[model samples]
Structure formats: structure tokens, C-alpha cells
Target: MNGYGSRGSTPGQGRGFRPRGGVGRRPYPQDAQEAQAARPRKLSCPPELRDAFVEARDFLAGLIAALGLPARLGFGGVDPARDGRQITIEVRSLADAPDRPDERGPDGRQEPGDLAILIGKHGATLDALSALTNAFMHRNNSRDLFFSVDVEGYRARRVATLRSIAQRCATRVLREGIALELEPMPPSERRIIHLSLAANADLQTESIGVGSQRRIVIMPRDSAPPVEPLEDFE
Candidate 1:
């Protein structure tokens, strides 16, 4: 059996669940999927990159097992992301036991015994792992190495969701001719927002704030809100 990273979108809570970010976000469409901005695309592990890809795959598998998490790794192929290529491997849960609360051993440090822990509150740990792995590879390899670690297919699904949300927000921004702010997101998520809106000329997107407080604001090409049509009164 396979479960995606973090129990983000629950079965019944899909309609209500929004990846809550910082407070004070103005109302927008709850269903980002309806925006139709994000479309799924496939990537292949180029033969030239196979050796490098396998190196990361084996490293993460051993690390997970050493942590007492027996997982099956799936190579998600490499894709262009940021400066380097993004290589993702899906870590599937071999055991379906419910996530256990963080516990400290004799040393007094919390141990990772569940896949959920790898995902963190809002994928903090997951993002960290991606950074860590890339750093590890960079030190070990002469050529540039960029790797993104994901539990199951969370990264794939997340990419789609982010694209959708971006499109939804961009749609409203264009229609209302008003600038809108999205909840705070990590760099990877924010990247998705920016890439998703790159094709739209009527809208402009930028990141504001610093560190964890950083978020995206989508604005129409013009600052002033567009005039309301007479159709509203009729």
C-alpha cells in the first residue's frame, strides 16, 4: 500500500481543506483546481543522468531504513526546476500503521518513526531534506547536483495544487483588476506560484517579506481596479 506525504487533503475534507498559510489573506476561490492553470507533465530520467540519479536514490533509501522507516523508493525522474534539475524519488510507506507521536530516546532527541514527520507541519522537513540532499550531492559530486526528496507522490500532487491555486488567484486578479496576496509559502511552493503565472501578461507576481514570513502578491498590470460594468445593476 502507498500513501502520499502528509494527510493534507483528507477524503471528506477536500472541499474545506486549504493549505492554511499566514493569516489576513483575502477571500478567493476555495477550489484552485477550477482555475485550470496547472496541467500534469511527465519527465524521464535521461540516460546521461542515470548514474547521478541512482546515487541519490540509494543514499535516501539507506538513510530512511537507518531511521527505522522501511519504505519503497520510486524514481520520479528529473525535471527542470530553478537552477538545476529536480530529481524526485517517491518514498512509499510499506507499513500503514497510523503516525506515531514524536518520542525522545535516552539521548532526549525526538526520533522520526513516521512518514508524517518527514513532511512536517507544512512540508518544512520535506523542504529541508530536499535542500540537504542537494547539498550532500554537491559536496560528493564535481558536477552540479540538485535533488528534491518527496514522500510517495506528494511533490507531484503538490506541484499540481500550487499551479492550480496560482491560476485561481491570477484569474481573480485579472477579473477584479485588484492585487491579491496569497498565504506565506516556502521557496519551492512560491516557485510554483511564479512559474505558473509566468505566461499571463495581464498579471504580475512578486514575493514580499523575508524568511518564513515570505508570501506572493498577484497584481493586475494596472494598479487601479478596473471599472465595473453596467451589467451589475441590470
Candidate 2:
């Protein structure tokens, strides 16, 4: 008599075998509910700020219309820094019409294009428009406010990309025991990188260089030398 059956048998393949619980199974209903509840609420402007927000939004809308761009503007809300001194207003563009004939360039020559002309090379035109808007707001109001203009969510997506790069650089710094330098970026983008790694205790971040050459450097926390203790003459 053969000791083993013709079919090869695994320990768990017997007729009474029972699979382990929670293996290859979806999360429990309570777990899913808790995760949904943990999500953060959307940012909203304070009651006091609503009037100012509306004013700014209307001003921008009028400006856009005056430029002859067929786009609608919407306010995303104010993001106030923890220090309360800085606030950024998000402006989203809703392009609803076909491209119009290009408007005259600064030199009186007809430039061929549509509202996209506003989003110049790397958004230079948009930046210029934002600067003008900010100046207008300051001149008309008692409060000195800073403004950032975002066209079609460009800034939001850029921020997300910067955060991903920051994370990758941080991981490299922690694993390789060496410092890594990121390409020079504008102040707003640099802030994103700094915030992304702010919670990582194992990594230290610093911005070096000046002006456009400035960039972020990530190094291991232990890379810095210990401070020497001062001697007491007495």
C-alpha cells in the first residue's frame, strides 16, 4: 500500500481546512468609517474675512473682464500662516469660451493668441498681473495684504510635485548619510519643500545661496557638529 495518495497534498488543503481570518480580506467597516472621519475638513475663511475676500474676488473678476479674457474667477479661500502675518488667496480660472483674437502687445503690435497669453512663459504674465492686483488692494485698503494668483490650479499641482521631490531627497539623505542639494526654486516653492520635511526628525533642512540661486539642502541630523561648551573662568 502506498503511504501517500496520488494527488500531492498540502497541510492546509485538507477537506476541513479553514482559511485564516483577515487574510486577503477588505478592511473592517469600522476601520473604513474611522478613516473617513479622520480626513481633515476643508479650509474656510472666518466671518470677519468674508467681506474682504468678496471685495478681492470682485476686483479680480473685473480686472479679468477688462483684459477681454473669457474666463470666470473663483476664490479658493485664504490660507493664513500660523504666524498670522501672511495670507494667500487662491484664484481659480474657469475658461468658458473659445480663444479670441490676440490683443495688441505692449509695443502696439498684434500678438496672436488668447487668454493663454496671460499665462506667459513660466507664468510671468500671471505673476505680473498678481503684483498689480496686490498693489491695487494695498492702495485702496488700510490693511497691507499679500496676494498670490493661481491660474487653472497650476500652483497647486506644482506644490504637490515639489513635496514629492522633497520626500525623495529626504529619503536619500537619511539612507546615504550625505547632504543633497535641490535645484534653485522660488520662495513659495522652497516653502513647500521645507514644510514637507518639517516633521522628519532624522533630517535637517536649510536654504542656502541668494536670490534665484537659492536652493534647499537636506542633510542628516547627525551631520552637524556638536557645539563646544564654554569654559568658566571661575
Candidate 3:
């Protein structure tokens, strides 16, 4: 969610987060499951898809090792949608991950190596890794698909946390009868908040702000006024 779409004179912090789809109730999905579900499935499995899956997993394993993580993977699996594809690989442990920065080199000191650090501020690095995997696997793609990487159970845990945050904020908003703002979060997390509260008929959720500073505002449905829609990318 980008650009603050102010709702009346409600008081809050600097503008908050935005998510996929344009402003105005865009539900482009915020999590891996939703993303995979969004894809259209093919009726029959294509032969090349099996090869693609094997190729993708093997490639991912190599990529992980090349990135300096070895034996850290618990396992990875594929979720084929009739004809589409979704492969998820996991980095199970950071026990072997360095707690300190690497030796100095011409490029300057390297930061400590950990899957968590590689996950970036909001799974940004993970997204990049996914894109890279797909790029390498594109030739094997007899069908379009989505590829993603997760550290431990981070994504799943985060989804649960976001839902908790949403519920907590919603309760406060309803109790106080005023709009409330939440801490800044990425589009994916924001999407979870939106999805978690989507069923409440008495409440409304709005995302505001631009770039990394964006977030969500919880307010009453009857009191919600029209605000320009915002768009966000995972």
C-alpha cells in the first residue's frame, strides 16, 4: 500500500503500508498459499512439468550450497496445480550460520551469513531467490509456475502473527470508536491483516502510505470515507 489515503481527520502515525492490486479493495493475495491459489490450474499434467520440478529442486539445492548454506535444508516439495507449479524449499537451521561478519576482502567486510539476514527486512531476499530460481527453471517450464523459499517456518509463523495483530487492532478500534494505525509492514504482511479481517461486517480496513513506510488503518465501516486507492508489490 503506497501513498496515504487519509480517512477524514483521524489521527495516526506517518502513513502506513500498501499491498498488491490498486487502491480500493484490491485482493491480489499477500501470502504464498494465496499466490499459488491465484494461479489457474491445467486439467492434465504435462510431462515436462515433472522434469521441471526435479530440475527446480536440484537447482535450488545447488543454489543454496553456492550461497554457502549446506546440510541446512530440511526438505523441499512441489505443489502442482493440476497443470501449474509451485515449489517451496526450506532452510531449516541457522546453527551453522555465522554469528559474525566474514573476513575483509577487496569488496569490504561481508555481513554475517544467515538465512534470516538473507531473508531481508521483509522476505525481500527470499523473493529475489525465488525469482532467480524461476529464471533458471524457466527453460523447463512447460507451464507457468511459482517458486518460493522459506527459512525455518518464517512465512507460516508470520501469517499467524499478522492475523493476531489484526484481531488485536480491530478489537481496539471497535472499543474506542476511532480509527487506529498499526506499525509499518510489507505488502505481504499487510495483505494478511486485510484478509484476516475481511469478514467483519462492522469494520473496515484501509492501507496507506508509500514505499517501506506504508501501513494499515482500522476504522468503522459506516464512518469510512472514500480515499484514493493504493497499489503494492510483494
TM-score per prediction, in order, is 0.62, 0.55, 0.59
How do the candidates rank by TM-score, highest first?
1, 3, 2
lDDT of 2 by residue, 166-219 (tens): 675676667767676665566766788899999999988888889877877778
In candidate 2, position 215 carries an lDDT of 72
Steric clash pairs (candidate 1): none
lDDT of each: 0.57, 0.50, 0.54
What is the per-residue lDDT of model 1 for residues 1-234, given as tens digits with 9 covering 90 to 100? Answer: 221222211111011122234334333342443222112123456677777777777777777777776665655656654444666765655442234223322222122336655676446777787776777788857645577776634555456656766776677677767677666678878888899998888887878889998977788875745322111000
Q: Candidate 3: misplaced stretches above 4 Å? A: 1-50, 74-84, 94-113, 224-234
Q: What's model 2's overall lDDT?
A: 0.50
Candidate with best TM-score: 1
Stretches of model 1 off by over 4 angstroms after superposition = 1-51, 80-86, 95-113, 224-234
RMSD of 2: 22.8
State the local distance difference test value for candidate 1.
0.57
